[model samples]
Target: MSKLSEKASEYLSREERLNVLSTSNKAGENNIAVFGSVMAVDDSTVMLMLGENTTCANLRENPRAALLVYVPGKGGLQAEGCRVYLRLRAMEDTGERFEQIKAGIRARVGDAADMLKHLAIFEVLKVRPIIDLGQEI
Candidate 1:
């Protein structure tokens, strides 16, 4: 159970934003997808929506991922820019925490979110900030 910094946590949950999820299989095939359902389970832990597809399969083979999350300017030139590179280690389980994650997905997206089956439970290994020029604008 790892936790993210307060700032990182706030950024992830501030609004539903798109992030890039990159994973690779044991054979080294790259898989990338745009995910918007990322959320911090707590401070050091995060959860993502997994579909029955390539991204999930990649994680099944290699439980590692790098998620790129960037927040665009809020108003024209005033919003501060923030970008993060998140290192994650994922697992599949139906344990208590997984259930909590399931509950969260349903709560956020409603019953239509049932397409989610397995929980890509991940621990935040690292949080690297990437400076963007837009923020300085």
Candidate 2:
């Protein structure tokens, strides 16, 4: 497993950062969604809760995905963030992580948390600068 750099990990630690998750189905149909629940569990692990939606279904067919963490910059592409390549490690509807995420959502959004369906865990494959100038995170 590849570990994310301290910079990348730190970027993910911020709760208000924008997280955009991208996934593709078996047929190559792509899907992208913005989420606030995505989080880094460790240098090489990430977790998020998903409902019974296209993102979840796409992951079931194809485990590979990418998460873009974006922090706005003063101008142009001077953003402070990274794009994390990932592979699905597991998906569970019930477990410690699931319970934690569930409770967190419930606390943050009240009854809207009921929409959460499964907790998805992913292994970090790589981390790169958001601008992708061939530089590593």
Best by TM-score: 2
Clashing pairs in 1: 2-44, 3-43, 3-44, 4-43, 4-44
Question: What tens digits encode model 2's per-residue C-alpha lDDT throughout 1-137?
Answer: 68989999888987658899999999999999987788889888999988999999999999999999997654466778999999999999997868988998899999888889999999999889888777777
Candidate 1 error regions (>4 Å): 1-3, 74-100, 107-112, 132-137
Each model's TM-score, in the order given? Answer: 0.72, 0.94
TM-score, prediction 2: 0.94
Model 2: pairs clashing at backbone N, Cα or C within 3 Å: none
lDDT of 1 by residue, 1-137 (tens): 23466666767876755578888999999998977678777877777877688988888788778777667656454343234334446555567867777787789789856777677767776665435443221
Worst 10 residues of 2 by lDDT: 71-80
